[model samples]
Target: MSYRIRPAEQGDNEAILTLLQGTPQQGAVTLNFERQPDYFRGARVACEQPDVWVAEARDAPGKVGAVYNVGWRHVWVNGEVRPIRYAHDLRIAPECRNGMILHRLFRHLRKQLAEGEWMQTTVLQDNQASLATVASGRAGLPTYYPAGTIETSMLYTRQRMPRLPADIAIRQSGSADLPDIAALLKAQGQHKQFFPYWDVNRVHGDEYCYGLNASSFLLLRIGGELKGVLGFWDQKPIKQTRVLGYTRGMGMMRHLYNTHSVLRGGMRLPAPGGVLSYLSLHSVIVSNDDPELLRLLLDYAVAFFHGRYDALICGFFQQDRLAKVAERYRRRLLLSEHFLVSYDGDPRGTLDMNRPWYVEVARL
Candidate 1:
C-alpha cells in the first residue's frame, strides 16, 4: 500500500488521533490521543511553517498514517548561535510500518534544514527499533546511556528541611518571573529545545498553568537573583502487571517511553497519590564564583517538595551531573531503560535532567 506523506492540515485532527490510538504501542504511555486536540492543533500550526511533515495513506484521503513533528531552535553551543532542528514526535501507524516512512521523513526534514545547521535527538537505551532507526541513518554515532544511576526522590509533607546557609531563598514565580527563568535556564547550558522559546507564553497566555493538576513550579533565588527553578507533577504509577499484558506476546517486549517501562518487571515503585510531583531541578545559575549554590538550591528544592507533595519523581538522563546529587538523597531510580528518538542528529552529549524534557512531563 502506498502512503502520501505531507504536512498535516487542521482538518486532519481526528484522523491523526485515530491513527495514534490504533497504534497499540503508544497506548501504554497514557498518550490519550483522544484528548490531545490542542497538541494536534499546535502541531498542525507548526506544520504550516514548512519544516514539519505528516504521512497519510493516499487512498484514505485525510487519514494521517504518521506524524513527523520537527522544528528548529537556535543553540549557543561553544559560543556559536547554530541552528539545530529538534525532532519531537515521530509516530508511524502499525499497518504502515514500512521503514521508508521514517527515511522519507528524514530526507524531507534534512532538506528543510539544510542551511548551515545541525540536528539532534535522544532515545531511551532499551528502544532497539528506534535506536536502530537513528543509528543506521546518515547521522553521527548515537550515544547510549553511559553508566550512571538514575535516582528517584519523593517529597512528602513529613520531611524536614536541612539547615542551610543564609543566602538562598525560595520564591513563588509570577508572570513577571518568566523571562528571568528563561535566562537562568539558558545560562545553565540547557538546550533551547528543552525549554521551548514560547513555553512561558503558552503557560501564561491562556492561564492554563493553573489548570495543571499534578504539577507545581517555583523559582529558586539566592541573594535575590533567580538562581534556578524547580517544578514537579504527580504521575500515575505504572502497574507492572497491567504493562505485561501488552508486552506478553512479543519476542522482545517493547517498553513505552519511560513511564510504562519503569513499571514493567515488578520493579515499579509507588508514586504519591494526592498531588504527586515530579521535580525538575531546572538550571542553577549562580555567580561565576558560587559553585556550591547549585547543591544548596537542589537540597532546598527537595525539602520544599517534601513539605508540599505526597511523592516526588525526577528524571535523570545519562551523564547528568544532578544524578550524582540525586544519589545522595536516596532517590529511587524509576525509568532509565527507555530512550527517546530524535531524527535530527547524533544523540551524544550530556542529557539535561534539569529542564522538563521527559515525554511524561510535557505531552503526557
Candidate 2:
C-alpha cells in the first residue's frame, strides 16, 4: 500500500480519533485512550510545543493509518533547565501493522530530526511486540537505549490523613500563591532529572494546565514557609480512558472487585465501555526531595480529593524512593520501561544517571 507521512492538519482530527478508538491497548483490561470533542486540545496539554504527524494511504484518501506526536517542554536535565522531547501517543491501525509503514514513518521522522537530538518514550513491559521492533535495529530507525522503569499507580483516595506537626498546614492555594509554587518547584526540581521547570505563565496560560488554576493546587506550608505543592489536572473533557473489554479472568472477577472496592471505599472497576474517572497528579515538588514531605503532600491530596475522584494517578521511576510513598496506599500499578531514543547510537553512555528520573505522568 502506497503511503505518505506528513504533518497532521486540522482536518485529520476525526480520522485520527477513529484510529485511536479502533486500536484499544491490549491487556487484561483493554482500554481505548480517546480524545473526544477535540484531539488537539489533549495533545496541547501534553506539551506546550507539539509536532503531530499522521500516515495517510494514497488509495484511502481521508483515512489515517497511523499517528505520532513529539511533545517538547523545558525540564531539569543534568542540573540545567533544557528543552527535551517526549515521544508518545503513537498509534497505528491494526490492519496496517506491517513493518513497511512503520519503517517509512521512522524514515520521515529521522529526516526531520535535528542532529544529535534525543527523546524519551515508554512502552508497557508486557508489550513484547513493540519492544522487539524497537530492538530490531531496523534501518533508518532511532536507537532505543534502556533507561529505567516507571511505575504508575492509581492510588486510591479514601484514606486517613497522616498526623503532622501542628505548625504545618495543607490547603488549597490561591492566586497569590502561584509564584511561591513555581519557586518551590524550581528550587527542588533540579535534584530530579526530567522534572518540569515551569513558571507562573506556563501554569496559567499553557494548555498543559487546562481546566486548572491556583485553586487546583494543594500547598503544604510549615510556619508560613512553602514546603510542598501538588496540582490536580482533570483532563476528562478532552481525553478519556474507556474500558473496551477484559480478559476472561478479569471479567469473571469484575463484580467481586467492585464489591470489594465499595466496601473498602476504593475505586471500582468500571463496566466495559465506561470511562475512568480520575485526576492526573502533576507539578509535584517537595522540599529537599524529602520523602516525609512528599508523604504529607500526597496524603493531604488524597484526603482533599476523596469521594470527588476515583483515583489520583502518579508515577515515579523505580529508583525513586518517593515511589515508596504511593506504594503504601491502596492502588493499582502499571509498569513501563523508559528508553532514550536517538539516531546516534547509545546516548545513555554519555548521560548522567545519578539523579532519579521524574517524568510527568500527566503529560505521558
Candidate number achieving the greatest lDDT relative to the actual structure = 2
Best by TM-score: 2
Lowest lDDT 10-residue stretch of candidate 2: 200-209
Candidate 2 to truth, TM: 0.96
lDDT of 1 by residue, 160-234 (tens): 566765886765677677777667655654442233232444454232232322224566666887766665433
What C-alpha lDDT do the candidate models reach, one value each?
A: 0.46, 0.86
After superposing candidate 2 on the true structure, give the runs of residues whose Cα lies further than 4 Å from its correct spot: none
- What TM-score would you give candidate 1 relative to the actual structure? 0.62
Per-residue lDDT over 1-364 for candidate 2, one digit per residue giving the tens place of the 0 to 100 score: 7779988988999999999899887888998889997888888888878889999989988889999998798898889988888888889898889648888888888876799999989999878888998999877789999999999999888756677789999889889998898788888888778998877655565676677777878888999999998888888998999998999999999999888876675777789989987889888888877899888888877777887887899999989988898887889898999999999777777667888789799888
For all predictions, the C-alpha RMSD in Å is 8.1, 1.6
Would you estimate the TM-scores of all the predictions? 0.62, 0.96
